[model samples]
Target: MSSSEQPVGEVQVHPQPAPPGSGPWARFVTWAGQDTIEDYSLRYAPKSFRKWSPMACAITALGGIAYLADYSIGASIAVSHGSASAVVAIIVAAVTIFLTGIPIAYYAAKYNIDMDLLTRGAGFGYFGSTLTSLIYASFCFIFFALEGSIMAQAMKLALHIPLALGYVLGSLIIIPLVLYGMTALAKFQVWTQPLWLVLFVAPIVFIATADPKGFNGFLTWAGDGGTERVTAIGVGAGAGVALSLIAQIGEQVDYLRFMPEKSETPPWRWWSAVLAAGPGWVILGAAKQICGAFLAFYVAGKVGFTAATEPIQQFLGGFGSVLHNDTVALAVATIMVLLSQVKINVTNAYSGSLSWSNFFSRVLHIHPGRVVWLGLHIAIALALMLGNMFAVLNTILGFYSNVAIAWIGAIVADLVINKPLLKLSPSYVEFKRAYLYSINPVGFVSMMVGSFFSILAFYNVFGDFMAAWSPYLALALAFFLSPVICILTKGKYYLVRPNPIREEIEKEPLWAGQTLLDIVDQKRYELPDMVHDCPFHGGTISSLTCTLTKCHDLCKTSAYIDSVTTATLRNAAEPQPTT
Candidate 1:
């Protein structure tokens, strides 16, 4: 039997690589097919693999966020608060999302790390970031289930299928599509971009052309709240609900992390790609949210509040006005919902797997693979779907936004304030587990305080006014508190130990007559000259190494890189057979 298949006690000293087409599914299950290391789970994305142009990557990343959920969210807000508040809230949320997303997008692309990894070095520290991982993973699955629920509704409307089975099919469809990761997703997004854009705008255009009265209705709609003019509480509550989307930057980072190095690409192209794919997502999202409000307003008079809030129903009504036939309108709306849901859910599933992988690998000290986590994320989302998550959409998002905003706010403060203004934190992100402290109070404490207060306010613990503005409170506290804590701690907690090897190499030229190990002190380092494969980053390198004990203590056990010698040592340390 091959070494990979052999029992643990009889592990091979030098296991041979699996031959071509000899994997679990003959070939489809191979790591190559799975885009094994392309997404750079445990390490930085290398320059060689980031060959896609910035525009190509940006468009793909933007395409994934082209979901109908924005429409649902906008419609819900408009239905509850009226057109003025919904419009005000969407604008407020868009501006906030755009501003906060900038620093995160730049850093993720520049550093070549996902949101979880970025959170680690930005201020949260190594193990401190585990909390954000959970938050991020929750964002993925929650949105996945939400997007899936919408797809199921479309299925019920278009195919006349039962909601129970529709939920299962909707949840199951994206698994195979997301299995291949960014390589496949990039293509899917690019190919579908034109069609998605066409369908997305068509219903709005038809409303403008065929039913001008409907457009006017959207202008004066007061909604179920019976508030014609925007109120402070309404705006605050609406913004709070809308700001829950702050975590979307984390999703954008999932794609931005794949961006090629800026130095290698043209300056204009690189910056354009970074901004467009990063903070620029809100541009499109804002437009969709407005369209959703418009549609909700147009439909509310005919279908009632609850029914108007549903994207499938809203679009069905919109298309019905234009198409003049119920069957044709249903077909068009169903196809739009399916296309949009699939586009977004693949992203949700892919990012969730990455987040879960980071969280589990750090917490459990083992990572089976991204594919394993992918299935786990989908399964959880499916469970949520079965529980009828669609019914509690507003409650779930309003509550979730507080936690998400706190997490993003803290990270942004560290990047924008601590890193640049005060220089309290390190200028460059230090994600290597070996060099970072397990917990940095700067981000962790700030996030905790922010989330705690915001959540309390959300539940009316802080009274009605505070409850209405809880998300702003969360953002304010996290953003300001991060700098305060960084100043208080004096940035000493950012690193557990100084990385003298990295320090020494920075001063020398790349072509200097010395290897990276030549600068590393042999007495302080371990496994010198042997290649080290980072368990977290999935990169193989020979420039640096540390002892198993040191690796466990500093890097966390799961992120420890393995050299040939270390592998053999690990094997030897395993319990020996009896006579």
Candidate 2:
């Protein structure tokens, strides 16, 4: 291992072309065979692979956020601010998270870049964005622990299971499912999302509709000292913690990358689906927070105030009132908890595996495949669960949110502002490691400066409003700093150079105006077709039109998309070349 560790396929700048004329499969497999995923996923999400619609993707993306903590947030905010102040804080946070999430979702879908790739082009460089990956991975593990803890808590409540075993089961439950990646995740989310929503909402619905007077009291009720005053400082403190969720957009983008490119489909419907699934998750998330508050308030009223912050308790208690059967109620809560955790944790596990693969590959030049890192990632999450991270959800999430929001805010600022008005960054996104600098000052610097000050404020080092909503301060600082850095640096770090690569020639369509042809050479054979050679896995695929086996595209005229490759054409590719 030399000074750097980037595995052969982790992604790199100026990747050498497959040693001049290797077998087509060998070359294709080498260039894009899917190196442990993090880097492989950095490139285009192929059309052959895109199967889910935007709606399902959105629902699944929002599935994991069905966390028990929403109740805790609602109860904490309500208790601290009274119902009125909490309502204001929830609304402010929901709207802010929604608006910021929109452009991010759009870009991820349209361009097919994961959060890391988006950051690479937005302002962060190849290595620079790894810091953000670390930040993002932190969310995954921490949430992993938090969600597991909630499940463990539920287990303790419903079955008297040990918290330790519950923790182990909660984290491990997602392992086998996520191993299959999105294919399994999509089905899991679809089968379970409806029940989760119903069970999650039934308690709030029954309590509110049944007791309007009680609900009214909840809304008007003030905290111990909250009466006769609306302290902006108190409101800001509550709002700050809520705003930390702004980073949740990164999770949304992770799935949005699977969205198929917009085509002849009606622009309105396609855009709407992407929009609804992407940033629109914030709308649903905010609604859940409100719903959580309602549940917490109702549960507290029915079962005393001390237990208000426990969501599993609140939801179970609420569900029990309507179901009228202890066993049924128990089952619903368990199903709800398991489904929500799997939906999100699978995503967490999947995204985290990719992140670590990229980090280790780039820094160490190793490619251990996604499965290897997937195990490692779960281990980290398992360790955290064992460490009792669940008990300190507020502290861990609050600090993590500061860094996550700063990174996300910088990327958003570049996409929404820098690319359009200033023209500092490119219009399209690029994720190849070969095409980016090790670090870009624009995103990297903005995030550090923002996170540094924001974390300080979070610790009460800044005093006053700065202390209460430090995460928001980080968001603001990053947003302001990204463009400022772009202007100051003149946006040189956007890309070392543009990508001119086409992974598969079939990806390009033969249009109505363009004559299409496929020609194969029989005599100039280089190697036996694997379809013919490999007997272990019988050639399960065959297509006369688009043969699954590699054809003589290497020698065919149609094979050479251009005589010149992307590297040779980068200087040649004029931005937005004419048809």
Candidate 3:
């Protein structure tokens, strides 16, 4: 028998000590690190913590897409570039988002990791993913400000509050709710879903019933372009703006990581939850955009084209059709706007916290906890809200789409093509800092090259046509370049060392319900729950290593092996008595 296959009875088990430091600051940090609140921001989410049912996790994820920003985006696109162009643009963007989101969402749920962690193993490597983390964080705060702006507009209409003060109030209200993380968010989203659905659907139903002719008029509306025919530039520009939402898959995976393991849940239930909550979010999002375009057309005569893009006005006009009383309609409209914005902004804030946590932890090597970053994220969003970011929303989103799609495209290529087809990257994700290179050229170089040329195209360096089509250019380059670069580099940068735990698993397979001892912390962990690589040692460790003891340095090359297998190997090696 090998030394590693020694008898289980011969091995000694030692209990690990508590985390260092008992100061007030340390205590506060400890408090913030609570599993119920922090939700494993910096590491793999173990099976023990992913207790929520797949359906429940899916609902929570879907609830985040309830932002009223889609209404504004759709309305703006339709008004700027005719209904025909808007329809094509919305469909194209939705299809791209749905297809790209599938591989990312499936990998996240299967691996029990977030986007940042997934990026590390996919191709970007350890530090290369930090840039994507910044991109994702920017997505969260940008949308938070946008959603907060909508809420402020509703407050201004309902209570006659000033927009500046309303922005502050709107941003502040979500702080308390998000401070507790997934524990608070899951319950809150599920509880409010029924009401949000009713409010969301009622206005569309009422508008269709009361104004049948208005729907037809919306179809013929030529917009500011004064042409119903779909031009290439119009489709491209509108799609660019809509594609800014591609990063939303990051937010979806944040909740999908909490889904119960596939082995634990029924196969049908598992896939259904993943698809429904993952890429399926864009289905409702696209419908909402089309509905917003129609609503904008319905109210365009009463309010000017510019004012029609505002969600507050759209809902007010929708409710006015149903409720004859102007005061009641205004009140109901304001309530719906508030409800929608609140649901989405909380998600924005929560996902932003996780992104910021990942970014700064790698950069500064110090994590004050996700709650501190939560405050930072909200502050940045508040600043944007006060700056009237909603006024130039299309311009900002159009430009941002170039970089956002490049990041997502590179990830998708690595997941769908490189790992599966070329077999350059590993089949499994390796996110531990100990095993990953600081950066990998396959994904990092592809994103950089894609973003550089796309930005130039966006600025009209090539031509007006190329400028409008820059986002697609970015997507294609990143997607194709990832595999080419992987081939050129030969995948040497993917891992610093072979994963010893995985090597051991290949030698002797572990089954469910089996118990294994963690050699470092000396704790017993069940089969699948103990399979995670230790962030410090780059070998198998107890899932609770960092959380239970907060000790990273003490473990060196630790691994989990089955006690029964060790005993059998030991018995076979010993001399048989008088045989």
TM-score for each of the candidates = 0.85, 0.79, 0.87
Q: What is candidate 2's lDDT per residue for 461-575, written digit by digit as tens?
A: 9787777678788889999999999999898887654333312222442221121111221111101000111122222111111122233223223224243354467876768
Give each model's whole-structure lDDT. 0.78, 0.66, 0.83
Candidate 1 on 419-468: residue-level lDDT in tens? 99999888777776666788999999999999999999999998988988
Q: For each predicted model, how many residue pairs clash, with residues at least 3 apart or on different chains? A: 3, 8, 0
Q: In model 2, where is the ten-residue run with the lowest total lDDT? A: 521-530
Candidate No. with top lDDT: 3
Residue 334 Cα positional deviation in candidate 2, in Å, after optimal superposition = 3.0
Relative to the unseen true structure, what is the Cα RMSD of model 3? 6.5
Note each model's CA RMSD in angstroms.
Answer: 8.7, 10.2, 6.5
Off by over 4 Å in 1: 1-38, 500-551, 554-579
Model 2 earns a TM-score of 0.79
**Stretches of candidate 2 above 4 Å error?**
1-42, 222-229, 301-306, 324-327, 500-579
